[model samples]
Target chain A: MDSYGLLIDFSACIGCKACMKACKEANNLPGDPGDHLSYSDYTVVKQQGDVFYRQMCMHCLTPTCVSVCPVGAMAKSPEGAITYDGSKCFGCRYCMVACPFSIPKYEWNKAVPVVRKCILCYSRIKEGKEPACAWVCPMGATRFGKRDRLLEIAHTRIARWPDRYIDHVFGEQEVGGTSVLMISPIAFSDIGMRNTLPNEPLPNLTWTILRKIPNIVITGGIVVGGVWWVINRRMELEKENSNGKEGKVEK
Target chain B: MGRKGKLKNKLFLFLPISLMALLGLFLTFKRFYYGLGSVTNLSDAFPWGLWVGFDVVCGVALAAGGFILTAIVYLFNAERYKPVLRPAILTAFLGYILVAVGLLFDLGKPWNIWHPMVMYNPHSVMFEVAWCVILYLSVLALEFGSIVAEALKWKKVVNIFHAVAVPLVLTGVLLSTLHQSSLGSLFLIVPQKLHPLWYSSLLPLHFFLSAVAVGFATVILESYTSSKFLKRGLELDLLVDLGRFLWFALVVHLTVRWQDLFVSGALANYRPGSLEAIAFNLEMALLIGAVVLLTIRRTHRSKLGLFFAAMFALFGVIVNRLNVSIVGMLSDTQSGYFPAFSEIIITAFLAMMGFVAFFTCVHFLPIFPQEDHNAKAELKVQLSA
Candidate 1:
């Protein structure tokens, strides 16, 4: 089965925040909707002048959080959601530090805190239903479907009405493609999206160095062991030579 | 002085340490009960703060003396430096133990600290570091165990430790090299979050080289301070020889740092009065100053000059670590973080505990070469028994 994705069309959003309300209801979150993502608020909507944008986990195809987690607590689900296991987390917060989008939030107030982030409604998607945000969007702004189908739809929409949408699709290739895609009339950068991320996945940067550990171990072991042997042998030879000379003189 | 005067003198020393330990305990209780937000300045924007930067990162680097001195004395056969070797190992053992303690304070679910051991994630740099640190800590304990066995007159245990001494030292060195660099690798994923001045593809190399330099400097500092406090003759000759190694390490580190900056085009990111640039320049200046001082014949031979040079190099490494872990990320994160009072007090308490532990070990165990003859005599008696 193809992985699911969400296409957030900023141009069509009327900013009713019905999707935010539905998300709160679906996730059992209480209190008024927050303007920024927090432990209690997994996803948020903010206004940048006339444009409103949602901020949440990007759910990268090759997630940095999953790669950085020492305990495999952060995982990329088969359905394209970046799921987290609180029980598996030791709370080192490397995930929080490593996220390029700065998505993961910590439950700092609780004594036994865990990391919090959007899982793209993993359970709902796994049951073959759209995420609550996409299901409740009053203006068809947030659409959920197969990632490849969404890409095709995004490209067709861009080509059909070039004046209505920007030439670029926001998460199409950013950080090696995110499950959450976005299309907007204005530039993504203008609405506070991180536009400077590299096209390659972030995890590759660390893997390039980490993969050399075996070679390091083998080479380091040989060099150190070789030096130790050679030095000890030289010392033994010197001691033997000195003893021989002393015996000859005494004799 | 009489017995009464000696008791009073000891009491004077004990009071402050006891008070600080009590305060630290209280703060730790609060943190465990009330959570990290109650004790630290950490937030979503700054998940890592002073504890990670100072206690764990810098603490691990400062403890590099054990593997370095072991490699030099055991591998290279620099037996003349053996007098300082035991103290260096003891200091490192204490440093790593305290690093583990400090990590518990910083971790949210301190109870789950053992998850890294059971759960495997080979791709993560953190997984590599955790494994290396755990294995190296065991190796350090065994290396330090020989001293304990000597103190206890355990002839059989001492013999076993001696039999495996070479292999133990080699393993310690290998583990240290991997984790010292892997600590820097932890930051490699955040190219955009970390300031470019400190962020480069060569971060692991930079971390490892600087650790080697600081390792030598720390051993020098340890030697001078221990001799002064214990009323022993200063090993001036051995320390001066160590100074040359420190100077060489610093020069190599400085060259690599600047060359990486140039190659990465991060030099363009430098601004005259920016905090990151200022911190970077200060760190560089201290390192260069130490190298220059050690190069001079007058300073190289003098105890005061050598001490000052080592001090400069040590501070240089500390500043570089803080710049990488904290200061460099401030501009990108846009969240200011100053350690809370409780956090500062706890860190100070941990440092005090380390010092106390070091002093106690020196007083009790045979940690210096000058004590070797008597210890050997005791061992012979135990063997004959």
Candidate 2:
């Protein structure tokens, strides 16, 4: 099966947001309304001191949103992009809950709102093209390729510049891995990556409980419901035989 | 005078609902014709409005009486409680219908609702909730079918219904368990978005426990209303029994709830506008207060105390559902979504419909058992004691 991923190398990079500009134009997205509460930049450059952070959907291997949605609205394509179908969306905002990265933004300002996020340009990929963000990154900072090759490349860069690179690949272990990998100079946690997470995928935790719900409910219902039946039957037998002779109802 | 008294009682039912029903009718038109956006405060940020918070999640939980009642009468074999069975079933049926109606208003594309209904999406938690609701509604209807059949003098049909009642009740209980808990599980995906205090693996469990408590509380509330309006004997035994159940549910709910808080270490963040914390606290306090009052032997014995405790528990559970769905959920921008006046009125209308439907059933059918008359005799005997 064909697999794909995006790799962003911060150390080798410039801070120009050509990727964001290309993304907006390529996707026919409207201009930003100029607010933090608003998101026109599918990909943006965030600078903490001289360090520039380009952030968008990490396109996790195991997405939390996919597991939690009741209607299967947000989904992970086999090709590795975290794609969404607004037509299937229920407006529950549960997707907002599942995404630890807080990447999925709901169109809250609009009355008929749906969630919006980067798909790594699934449309372009379907047309056998790279995501506009990677294609337009002039610094050669963002590279799109197979997951295996990206990992090899990321590791080679780190080994080549031990003093310049943080040992950790941002998406390698976070939330059970991601399609998008990042190489940074500082600690990954410095850019707000959640450091404290179990090695297993988050869906594992919820999935374990979710899988057992039907069984537990069936068994719990039978046991609890059985007791109710026996008690009710005995009461019925008594009620019918006594024929209102009793003073207080024996509930 | 006797006929006039009957008419006066009928008037009592209509008095509470007429305006609300009319408004509900109007909104029912508006929601379908105009779309949810026209009349609601729902934004993309807050897609679910009062209808979802108040109706589907909390509304159905409030109506959990059907599951509990079925569990009590057909499963556990609680006999003396039979007097209120019909009323409880009727209350549940109407509660579910109201939830269904409420959902019709909340969906963004109500017209395309049938897509999910027809096309099976096993992965969607919503699909599970929807099927459970649909199947359970029918189960409830079948479980309560005997009552209507009994009233209609369909002796053969009533006998057939009685034979199936146990299984139907069991089905209803099972279906209810799926959806009632699934309601909370719906948020399991929103782990990052929900306020940490309310988010836990045990959400479904919390929902299940609260639904059980609320189910009994709803019946108690209805029973109190029944006693006053029907001039029937208030069944204090059921209240005492329900109180016992509520005490157990409260202890478990409190333990699990606080355990979640304690482990989450989220208790430190408690303050106003921390919707989940406030909601969690309110749920705990309301149930605890109800347990305290009703657990006292004398308190359950009194008509007024029992009535109030039941009402409080009902309100508490309702508030808890609303909080988990709306208030407790967190986003970076804490935009408070107040439901439009029209939204609130539509909710009121549905509630009025519930009461009116319940009253209509009780009046026409032999829903309140003749045994309720014995309460007066029991009271006289107590007086002598």
In terms of TM-score, which candidate is strongest?
A: 1
Candidate 1 regions exceeding 4 Å error are A245-251, B2-5, B230-234, B370-373, B376-385
lDDT of each candidate versus the true structure: 0.88, 0.74
Q: Write one digit per residue (lDDT tens) for candidate 1, span B339-380.
A: 889989989999999989998997888775454477565663
Best by DockQ: 1
lDDT tens readout by residue for model 2, A1-251:
25789999998677787887788888676785222323355677777667887888988898887876666777789789988888877655656655777667765434455678888899889888999989998887899999878988999999999898988888877788889999999877787666765557777766666678668877877787667656666766787677956464433
After the best TM-score superposition of candidate 1, give how far the Cα of residue B55 lies from its true spot, in angstroms.
0.3
Where does the lowest 10-residue lDDT sum fall in candidate 2 chain A?
A32-41
